[model samples]
Target: MRRSKTILLSLSAAVFITGCSIKPEPLLPKDIKSSVKKDLQLLSNIVKPITKAITLEEAIDRAVNNNIRNRVQKMESALAYKQIDMVYYDMLPSLAANAGYSVRDNYAASASTSFTNGQPDQISGTPSYSVSQDKERTTTDVSFNWNILDFGLSYVRAKQQSDKYLMAKENEKKVTQNIIQEVRRTYYQTVSADALLKRIVPMKDEVKDALVQSRKVKLQRVSSPMEALSYQRELLEVLRSLQSLERNLMNAKLELSELMGLKPGTKFELSEKVRKNYDLPEIKMALEDMEKVALENRPEVLESRYKERISSKETTTAILKMLPGINLNAGINYNDSDYLLNNDWASYGASVSWNLINIFKGNTYNKIAKTQIELAKEQKLAVSMAVLSQVHLSIVNFKQAKKEYELSKEYLDVAEEIFNLTEVGNDLNMNSRLVFIKEKLNYILSTLRHSSSYANVQNSYGRIFASLGTYSDMKKEEVKAKKVEKKLVKKIMPAVEKKEMKSPTFKTYGIATSNLNVRAEASLDSEVKYVLEKNKKVEILKTISIKNDVWSKIEDGYVSSTFLEIQTTEVK
Candidate 1:
């Protein structure tokens, strides 16, 4: 029975522990649904979609205007400024006004015994006086108090808050620079992916057609089973490779959409038309100049300096706490009572108070302040070191990326020339079908590599700019001149009108409410060809039910019906 009771107790304890355990907030299907709903509402209001090619400048502006992360940083900076205001109020004199009612249970009396005779042993007379005090009374008072020591402490606190407010601005600048860097990187990736996809998409269709013809030819011939199977396998492998590349291209587009704060799967074209022999920015400044620029302008370095100032002011505040306090107070009071004292009075007073124990603890306070100052200085030094290292590394990486991109271009050009030669030979019946396929694959692969390298070059430049804590038009020659003239406005840009494409005839159109897949079939496990961004327009041919979920068929593919907002239904 004892054993059974112990088991029961253990079970009870387990239950209690489980009940008290903390759970992470609801971050699953419900949160996802909520976010989809919000995106749908936001996109529905956007009448124009990006149909024309988007310039890098335009893309960056859109991201800065729409990104929630930048807005969050701006709000944080505003909160810091409000904190400075609150600290400033602390330096003002404290004023208080109060009124009260009091009741007494009895009258008050006083008596005095006096010896009128010059003899020490004799008491001449005894006199007494009595006065009836009111049973109830009302009193009111207004007072003002000012402590010089506290005011000095508050001044230091306000100064620290001001420095912290500057720190917030620096932090905002840092976040903005990072955002712009991301825009540059993702923009290049999107353009590269799009370029590669356009080239491979037609190639994929041609290869699929060729695969069908080859299988037909194999079946018509009385060839060895091994030979036929090998031919079929080769074609399937080619198809598989192309499919994988297509998927990667689709994913790259989705990522770009996300970075721009657009609905996932949104389709937009980039302005960079040529894939090869593209002109990119050149790094003109030397390493010394880069180091100097980074040290002076990098947000992290500036923020560290501000933090050191704030810490020094905080140390002053801590020392002030250990000092003696001197205060002045003034008040006027009014009372209504049936007593012989004055009913109204005005008074003023001054005081000086010190904690005697604090005198003995002065050394400890001084040590703490000293330690904090040293810590702040060390932190500042560490940040400076990190910034300098980042500048040097970024420059090296940029140069390396440029070299790699140039090499990739050479490889792509050679592949293109070889593919062209193979195509001509195949047309003249001098080259076998297998040789043509292999050359085509090589060309496609080289194209993809070239695109990736191009993106890397852009990303490297983005990193360089980020390390320097600035963003500017890379195509422009004189960045330093523009930086000096431009105001440091971290404000959001105004929304611009995006060009919209017209719909095809008799097509039922809908907007995607979430990032959704365009699948080969109306099934959950169907192969996904494209990912439609939220707010992207799709032509819906019909709707079909796949188990519990409804799906809409478009010209090229099918998508989930739950997140599709049919335009005609809404219009009606």
Candidate 2:
């Protein structure tokens, strides 16, 4: 009894010391950490403004790397790998170690006691108090268990998880291809709209001025009423068309900004000259051959095939679940109860168990698994057919777009010629100013149409690549290098060109990583006196370190160094 008390006191004191040394549980749930981190990131993005002019290649890179949908797909692929790890671990035997203590409400006692040497130890037939086994006991156990059926099921699950990971990768590729397609299409449209607007704006202003002048002449009776009204109506029609084009221009720019992960209304210039000669390259593959390649490479088809494989595995898993399983168990136990004959013991055994009831019910599960496998196969076939159709339709559309673009070029050329002739006639007093203006409007409209047609042709080409499931293979550097080589060969020029430019002399410069607040003071908590746009270059006068972060003093104010990157540039 004294030894038992000593052990109990020692254990209690150790537990008390350990409990005091350990940190308390978190006040908030552990899951909130991810949410908090994500929220901070979101806040940072919201405060940042995009200030760089993104190139085509840069835009595609950003879309693939930073777009939320693509990020989610990447996370899903990571999650699938984690799941495979979990299921694989489940296939291993389970091992557990545990310790426990228990005490009765009242001390365990017996109703009978040893007889004493008196006439009668009390009432002979009456019960007497007696000591019993220890009322409090402590137990320590270590156990290992393995069930064959569980391990088999876990193996199947692990295989399915691996397939899911592959499917996720394929899905991400599909998404990337789709995003690239959208980026290319929207970029072309945005650039075309910008070019069209440049032409439309001046023409629109001229038409407006003409209408105003014509109204004045009509009011003075200097111009014929019918002629004035007809000219005015024509100008109105041109203005309406210009207004519609302007609306489309805004929408296209907005969409391009969104795809490039820039804020809406962000403005930048495009290299329109590169788009002037986007003709379809020669196609040597036959339609049937293209279809075969698409079937073999398309992500959707591949994903469907993986799904079918997973379904088949699931069927095997279900069958295994219904089979009798052999379970092997081993344990070591320690007990501190006085009543126990053996205080420490080790046990090892194996047993086989079968759920007899599942024999009747498992048929339902088997049918379900079989049906799922069939469904997966059917879906795969459907995807294959759809992919073939997409390939054929894309080819037809590419051909049509090419034809239309070529015809538009011819139309634009004719319109330009007519406009030039009208100008000559007006100079010779053979045509009215109104006729010149009208012909000029026609030429501009033709130019716009041609530009739009060119964009359509490019889009059709992109669609063809997308249909082939091979758009991702198109490298931007190759295309850019080709364009550069052509330009260099065609237009050799001197290195020093005449230009009116300003060069700022600075000790050093820093590039802003976000829309940093340029405060009058160095502290971030200070008032935001001015906001520096993200990715903008600022001349740094000096830098000072506070804690682990640095603050840069610019010409205007101070900004955090954490958001600035030093840059070197040459002054001509």
Best by lDDT: 2
lDDT string for model 1 (275-295, tens) is 455566677778888888888
Each candidate: what lDDT?
A: 0.73, 0.74
Report the lDDT tens digits of candidate 2 across residue range 316-394: 8778877998999999999987877899999999999999987876888899999999999999999999999999999
TM-score of each: 0.68, 0.69
How many residue pairs clash per model?
Answer: 4, 0
Worst 10 residues of 1 by lDDT: 491-500
Candidate 1 regions exceeding 4 Å error are 1-52, 100-138, 217-221, 265-267, 338-341, 427-431, 472-572
